[model samples]
Target: LAAGCRTERATSVCLLRVFSVCVCHPEEKKSVPSDEPFRVVFRNFQRTLARPVLLGQGEAGAARGTLQVSRHQDHPEVCVYVDASSTLPFVPPKTCAFLGPLFPPLFSPIASFLPSESHGVVLILDGIIQCTERDEFAYQEMISFLPLCCHPNPQRVLIVGGGDDGVAREVAKHPAVLEVHQVEIDERVVELSKQYLPFMACGFESPKLKLTIGDGFEYMKQHEGAFDVIITDSSDPIGPAESLFRESYFELVKRALKPNGIICSQGGSFWLDAGHVRETLDYCRKHFPRVTYGLAAVPSYPTGQIGFFIASLNPETEFREPARQFEDAEIDQLGLRYYTTDVHRAAFTLPRFAAKALNP
Candidate 1:
C-alpha cells in the first residue's frame, strides 16, 4: 500500500490506496484488504472548507458515515452528524468543486467562491455573511419577488450588490422582466460564484441579463428613472455597504426608479438589529410616499430571520398583495423554492414587537 500527498497554494490533497490509510469513524472500523486497487481522495482547504467529504464505503455498497471540515481551527476538529444506524446504499453527495477562497477576510470581498459544508455555498465578506446557499432562498425569493411582484409590469429591473448569489436569477424568473442589469462591485465574486455556485450563477447566463462590473452607488448616480423595480441586495449595514443604508443613497435610488417604481432592500434583522431596520426605513420613507418592512426565515441570518425595507412611489400600492399572482403549479415550473404570493403578503405581518419597533 502506497500513499502520496500534495500541497498546492492553500490546499492539501492526499491520495491513499484502499489498503493502507483512510480517515473515518473509529467505532465502525472495517479492515480493508491489502490487494484492492481503489484509491481514496481527501482534500484540505485553507481560508475555508466549503464542502463535506463522505467516506467509508466497502465493496458491499454499505454506507458508513460523513465528515465535515471547517476553516475555523478553533472549532471542533471532526464532527459527523449523519445518521449512523441507517443501512442505506452508498450515494455520493453533491460534488461542490472548490473554486477558491470566498472574500478576503481581513480586507475586501475579492476572492474565490466555495460551497459551505452545511450552509450551501457561503460568501463571508469582512467576517459577515453575504449569502448562505441553503438559507439564501428566503432572502433571494423575498427580496427579488416582493417588489417585482408588486409592480403591474416590471419589465426593466435593477439589482444592486448580490452578485455572487441567485438574486439576479430570481428576478429573471419573472416572465414580465425584459432586462436585468446587475451592478456588482466585485467581479471576482461573480466569477467565483459562476464557477463554484452554479445554482446561484444561473442569472449570469440569461439573455435578458446584462452584468456591469461597477459600483451600485455610482451606477445609480449615473442612471435615473430607468427601472421599474430596484432590489438592493447589499450586505450588512456596515463597511462597503454602510452608505447603501443612508438617506443619500436612497435619494439616488429614488432618482433611478421610474415614477411608479418600487424598491426593496436587505433591511437587516428585527430581532438582532431593529435599530438598523428602523433607521434604514426612515431614510427610505423620506424618498418614497409609502414604506414598510418584510421578513423571511433564513436560519443563517441573525435571530433566524432576514428583513427587507420596502418603499413605493404610489401610496395606493400596498406591499402586501402582489400585482402578479402565481399558482402553485406555476411556482413549481419556475423552480421557486420560496416566495409565494401569500408569503409575500404575510411577510409584512410582523410580530407586535417588530411592528412597534419598525413601524413606530
Candidate 2:
C-alpha cells in the first residue's frame, strides 16, 4: 500500500490505493493503483466536521444527509440555504449568498425578484429598502390598509418606514385615501425596489402617492394632528429602527393623528419575539385609548406568525369589516397570499400569557 495526499484550496483529501505512485510531478501528477479497491474524497468548500448535522448519512447510501448552497441576492457575502436532499443537490448547512455587499452598503439598493425567505421581489422606487426577514407583501398590506380600513373615512394617510413602495401600492388601492404620504429615511431602498421588485410594488405610481425623504419621527413631530390614519411600517427594533419601537415614537404617532384617528404599526411577531411585542403593546395602551394586538401569518417570516398593534385616539372607533369581504371572495383579489378573514380574527386572539402581559 502506498500513501499519498492531494491538497486543493486550503484542505487536502487522502485517496487510498494499493501499489500506487506510478507518476509523481508537482504541477501535473496522476495517482496510479495496481488493481485494488481504493477510496477517494472530495475537498469540501466549507468545514462541516463540527457543524450540527440537520440530517446525516445512513446505511447503503440510504439518503440520510444533504447539503445545498446559494448566493443571497441582497447580501452576497452571506450564503443562503437552497435545499438539502440525500441524493443530488447536496446543500451546505447555514450558507446563504447575500448580494448586499456587491453594491456599496450606503447607497446600493437591491430588490428580491424571486420570493425567497423574505419579501416577494419588489422594486424600490426612491430609498434603500431591504427585507431582512418575513414576507414583504403580507406585512405591507396590513400596514397600509389596517388603519385605512379601521377609520370611518380616511382621507389623508402617512406611512413611516416603507420606502420599498409595497405599502404605498396598498394605500393607493382605497378610493377614500385621497392622499398617501410616505416618508422614508433611506432613498436607496425605494429606488432599488422600484428597479427590481415590480410586482410587490403594484400601485406605487398612483397620483395620490407623495414620496418624501426624511426622518419619519421628525416628520411626524412637524405635522401634528394632520393625518387621518398613521401607519408605521418600520422594521424590527435594531440599528436605525430602534427609535421607532420606543414610547416617544408612539407618542409622535398619536400626536400626528386626528382626534378620532386610527394608527396601526408593525409590532413584531407574537410567537418568537413575544417580549418585544408585549412591550410595544403596553406602550400603545398607555398612549392610545384603544390598543389591540392583531396577528398575520407571513410565510417568509420565521415562526410563520406576524403581529400589528392598532392604537386609536378615540376608544369609540367603528372597526368595520373590510368592505371588499376577504372571507367569501378569492384571496387573490385582495392581493394577499396569507391574510384572510380567519387570520384577521385569529390575530387579535391573544393567548393568556400575551393578554396578561399586555393588560397587566
Candidate 3:
C-alpha cells in the first residue's frame, strides 16, 4: 500500500511474478491474542512467470504494524484475497500453478486450508534467506547420500518428487551414480526454477539425468525394484503431497529399490511439524528394517529446521559415511556454496525436543 498499488484483475510486476504473500492484520481475527499480529494473505491465482522483481511489501496497517513478503508472483497487479483461519494462514492463488494446467481445480478453497511451504517463501529474520536455515541441506544430505554410499556400487538412482532439484543435484555428485531418474509431478516448478534458481536447477542439465513429468507414485509402481537408491524429496504433507508420507507410499518405495536398496525422504520440520514427522517415522518403521531420522538447516525453510527419514533393508551397513565420489578430489573440485562433509555429519544432530518427538 505504500508505493505499490493493488489492482482488481490487471497484472502487475509483483502480482504476476510469484505466488503468494502474507500480511498480518493482528486485530482482525478474534482468536488471535493481543500480542500476536493478525495474519492475512494475498494470493495470485495465475500462470507462473519469471520476472526481475517479485513483490513490494510494506507496512499498511498502523496498529502494531507488521510488514511481510511472500515469495514472488509472475503476473501484474491483481486482486490480493484474504483468508485468516488457515493452518499456514496465507495462500496465493497460483501456488501449485504447475499442476493447474493439468488439474484446474487443484487449488480449491478446501485445499487452501492445508499447509504448504513450496508455493511461497516463509518470512524469517526480516526477509533474509535464513528462512530455510532450520531445515538445512545438512540433514537432507545425510538422508540422501548415506544410503547411496552404503551400497558397494550405486549406479542407477531414482528421485521422486524432488522438483526443486536440490536432491537431484546432490545425488548426481556421487560418482557411482551413472544415471539418475528424477520424476516430478509438476513441470512448471522445474521450468520456473530453471529461471529463478540456477544453481539448484543445474541437476536438470546433467547428461546422466533423465527427467520425467508424471505422478511419482505411478512411476514407482511401474518401475519396481529398479533403483539402487530412491529418494523422495517432496513438499510437506498437504495438498497432493500428503500421500507421499503414508505407509502405502512407503510400501511402494520399499518395492521400488533393489534388494540392497535404500530410500530417503523429507519428514517436514522437527519443530513446527513434529507430529507429522513422528507419524512419518512411525510409518517408515513399519515398512523398512532400518529407519533413521535426520535433521538439516535450510535457511529458506521455516523454523530453521527440517527432517528426513532413511529406510533401508540393510542392518549391517553403517549410516554416516559419505559416498566415494563425494570424497574424490576431482568431484570435490566443484564450487559448492552449501554442502560439506562436516555439515553432512552434523545434520544428523537433533535437538532434544526433536529427538524425543520423532524417536520417542
Candidate 4:
C-alpha cells in the first residue's frame, strides 16, 4: 500500500489495496514493489462474507499476493489474513488490525474495534497502539496525575500531543488544575477519537479545557513561564513525534514551565528499548533540577507496560511521593481507576534490571 492509503470496509471484511498515489495527499506519490505483501485482520465475525475485494488499478491492483485467514481455537471471533510469502513489518502483537486509511503524510492514525477479551476499541497511530478503552485509564491517570500530584500547586496545565484527549480527561479530574491547555498537531486523531472513542474524547468537553491545534514546540516557545504543569503525551521517538524526545523539546518545555513547575512525558518502554529511555532521561535532567522515571502497566502497549519521565524545576521536588495525597473517598469522587497516593510512590520504584539500566 502507499504511505497514506485508505481501506474500505464491507459488511464483514475490509478491502485494502496498494495505490501509486497517497490518498490523504494526492500531490505525493509512493512507489511500491509489485510483490510487496500487506496483512489483513478480520474481527467481530458475525457471519461469513464474500472473499476479499481487491482495490486500486494498473500494476498496483495487479500486485501478486495470496490471502490466508487463520482463526485461533481460543478466539473464534477474530481472524488474521496475511500474504504467506511476506512478513507484516508494521502490525504489533496482540493489536487489532486497522481498517481506516492513513491520515496526513507525517502520521498514520488507525482506529480498530477489537474482541471483548482484548479490549473494546483502540486508537493506533503509525502502526503503534496509542490507547485501548479497557486499559487506557492506567496510562492516562499515571501520566496526568503523576506530575499534577507531584507539584504543590498545579493550576495551569499544558498537554502536548495528547490528541486522543485521554490526558485531558485525567488532568481535568485534578481539583487543583484550574485551566487545561492542549496542543495537538493532528486534528484527525481528535476527530476520530471523538467519533469512535468517546470515553476518552469526552475530556475535550471539559469546561476548563482550552485546546489549540498547533505545533507544541512552537506553542511552548510563545508561552514562557505560563504553565505550572506540562505533560507530553506523545508517541515513541519516531515519525511526527520524533522531535518530542529531543533535547530541544525539553529546552522548550523548561522555558514554558513556571519556576517550580513539574512536567511528565511518555517515555518509551524500557523493556523494548532501554537506551532510548536512558537518553530521554538524560535530556530531561539537563533542563530540570530533579528527574525520575515511573512505570505503568498498560496491557495494550508493547511489553504490556509503558514508562514516563517526570521532572521538576524545584531541586527538592520529590516525584516518587505525591505532594498532594488524595483520600480513598476523594479518589472515588474523582473516578480514578488506577492512580492512588501509594501507587504514585510505587510507580517510581523500578525493578533491579530497570534501575541498573536507567539509573546507570
Candidate 5:
C-alpha cells in the first residue's frame, strides 16, 4: 500500500494510468517458495518513471516504504503495492495465445487462479492452461473419441478429471452414449471453465454428463464394473495427478470398468519426456491385456504435442475397427475439426523412432 491502492476486488495493475510503470514477477504456488520477493506483483506509481528504482520488500503487513531512485537523489515521489496474497495475481499484459501473437511465448498468458467473477481463460503455471478455444478440441476430442469409438457402444463412460474442458461433450456426441459420469477433485475448475472458457466448458452443461466433485479413485472403488469406457482427463503427472498413474489406481479403474471396457489417459509429451511415456505405458500393460500409444498435436501444450495411453480390458478388442464409424456427413454434424475416422486409425501408427523405442 505504498502509493498504489487496493479496491474491493484485487488489482494487479495500478489504477492510476499515469503511474503505470510496473514490475511483474509471479510466483507459482509450489514451484517457488511463497517467501520469495518475486511472489508479489510490484507496481510503481509515478508521473515520470524514467530511472531504475529498487525498494526493499518486507512482509505484506510491513509499513509502506519509499522508492530509492538510483540516478536522482531528489526523485519524483512514487507509491507502490506488494500484493503477494492477491486472489488473481497479475503478470503484465501477456500474449493471449487464443488471440495469437508475434511471439507466442513472450505474450503467453499467466495461468493462475481466476477471480470468482472472471469469464476468460486463466493460465495457471503450476497446473498449466485450462483449455483454450483454439486447440482444446485437438486434445479433448482425441482423448475422448479414440476410446469411445473403439468400443462398440459406450453407453456409460467414466471421466476421471476433465472437469471443465469439453471432454464430456465430445463423449456425448456418440448417440449411443447414455450417461457420462465425471469425478473431479476440484469443482472450481468446472465453475471457472463454465464462465471463462465457454467453448470447451460445454462439457459440464451436457445432459449426459454427471459431475461428482470428489476423489476419482474412491469413486471408482465404490462403483465396480459399471463403466463401458473410462477416460482420464488429468493434468501433468505431478501432485494430485501423480496418484492416477500408480499401479493401485489402475486396479481401481479395472474394477470400475465393464468386462470389455476401454480406457484412455493423458500420457506425457513424447518429445519432452519419452521416459515418462515408456514408464506409464508399462503401468498400463501390467493391468490391461491390449495397450497402445497415440498422440495429438496441440500448439498450446508443452512441446506443441500431447499423447494418450489407451488400453482395453479384452484382449480381442481391435484398436483399428471402431464400433460405430462416422461418415463424412456425421463428422460435419458433430462439428469435429481434428478428429476424423481416419485420424482415429492413424493416431496409433507410431513414428519410426517411437516404434523402436516404445514397441521394441
Candidate 6:
C-alpha cells in the first residue's frame, strides 16, 4: 500500500475509501484499491488511521463498531472510530481538533488511564483535555482559591460547570465559606468521575454542598445577589459552554453575585490564543469594575498552561495581594498543592509579552 497523503486546508467532508481515506475538496475525488489499510492526514490536525467497516448490516454492523464524524464551523472534519468490543470502558480519541466557537459540534466525554509514571487518569470532553490527575490541583486550586482569597468574606460560593467536582472540593476548603452551591448540566460527567475518579468526585460529598443538575444560567437567575464568590469551572468555549464566555453571561453572573462579589473563570491560554484570551477578558470587563488575568501550569492542558479571568464588583479589589493570607500550616491543612499566599500574588504577574497582549 502507498504511504499516507497530506492535505492543505482541504474542504469540509473527508471521504473514506476502501484502502485509503481521501481528504480533499468536494469537487476533487480520487480512486484507490480496496485491500490495504491507510491513514488520513490534515495540515493542522493529527493523523489517524481509518479501518474498513460495512455501512449497514444489522448485527454484523453492530459488532463491527461505531463511526462518528463531526465538524465545527472553524475546524476541519473530525472522525472518531470506536471499537465496540474494546474492554476499556471509555476510549480516548486518536486526535482532537482546535478550539471552536460556542455551541459547536459536540463530542462525548472520555476518561482514560495513563500509563505514565504518575499513573494518572485524564478527563477529555468534546475532544479537549479537561484535566489530568497528575496536575489537576494546579487548575482546581487556582480557579477555586483565587477569587475566594481575594474576597474578605467568602461566605457563600457558587460553582458553575464543575461536574467533576474538583472546584467544589477546593472551594470547600475555605474556612469562611459556609454554603457551597454547584450546578452541572450533565450528570453523566459527575457519575463517571465518581466511579472512575473518586479523588475529585468526593467534592460532591461535602456537607456544605447543594448540588443541582441544571443549567447554570437559569440557576444564577433564580438566586440573585446570593453568592460572595462565583467560580465558572467550565470547559473550553464550545458546545454548552460557549455562552459562558460572552458578555451576556458576565451580566448574569454579575447579577447573581452579592456586593463586593468576586468571580474566577477558566480563561483560555494566552500562549495558545492571546487574542481569544483578550477577547474573553474584554467581555468580562464590561460588567466588572476590577478585572485581571492569572496563570497556572498544568502539564496536560494545551500549551502546558491555562489562565483564569478574575473580576470583582468593587473597583478597589486587588488581584495581586490576597485579602486573606494562609500560613504554611494552614496551607498544608487545606491540602493545597498549587496555591499559596505568595503564589496567589505571583499568578497575576504575567510575562512581558502576555501582559502587553492581555493587559494592554
lDDT values of the candidates?
0.67, 0.57, 0.55, 0.70, 0.64, 0.69
Q: Could you give candidate 2's per-residue lDDT for residues 1-360 as a string of tens digits?
A: 111222332221222212222322334333232232343333332211111111111110113232211212232222212122323443333322332332443332322222232222312211122342235667777766667767778899998978767778888876688999989887766666666566655556889988898889789889998999988887656546778888988888888988888888877665444667778878888888777877666543434556788888887764435433444455566566555655555566777887777666
Tell me how candidate 2 scores on lDDT: 0.57
lDDT of 5 at 327: 92
* Top model number, lDDT: 4
lDDT of 3 at 234: 66
Model 3 per-residue lDDT at 75: 23
Model 5 lDDT per residue over 1-360, tens place: 122222222222322112222322223211211232233343422211211111111211112332212222232222233343333233423232332111222212223422211223433332234354556778888998899999988999999988775788899887889998999877766765665567777777788878898889889989999999999987666546778878788778989999999999988766555666788888888899998898888765644667899999989888877777899989999888888889888888877888677763
Report the candidate with higher TM-score, 3 versus 5: 5
Q: Sort the predicted structures by lDDT, highest score first.
A: 4, 6, 1, 5, 2, 3
Ranked candidates, highest TM-score first: 6, 4, 1, 5, 2, 3
Off by over 4 Å in 4: 1-99, 109-118
Clashes per model (N, Cα, C within 3 A): 1, 49, 41, 0, 9, 0
Evaluated at residue 121, the lDDT of candidate 5 is: 42
List, residue by residue over 187-215, the lDDT tens digit for candidate 4: 87788778878999999999999999889
In model 5, the worst 10-residue window by lDDT is: 53-62
Q: Provide the TM-score for each candidate, comma-separated.
A: 0.70, 0.65, 0.65, 0.73, 0.68, 0.73
After superposition of all CA atoms, the RMSD between model 2 and the true structure is 13.0
Of the two candidates 1 and 4, the one with more favorable lDDT, higher being better, is: 4
Candidate 6 per-residue C-alpha lDDT over 178-225 given as tens digits, one digit per residue, 9 for 90 to 100: 999999887766776787678899998999999999889999999999
Model 1 lDDT, residue 117, Cα: 46
Worst lDDT window (10 residues) for model 2?
52-61
| Error in Å for residue 130 of model 1 | 3.0
Error of 1 at 320 (Å): 1.0
Task: Kindly provide the TM-score of model 3 when superposed on the true structure, using C-alpha atoms.
Answer: 0.65
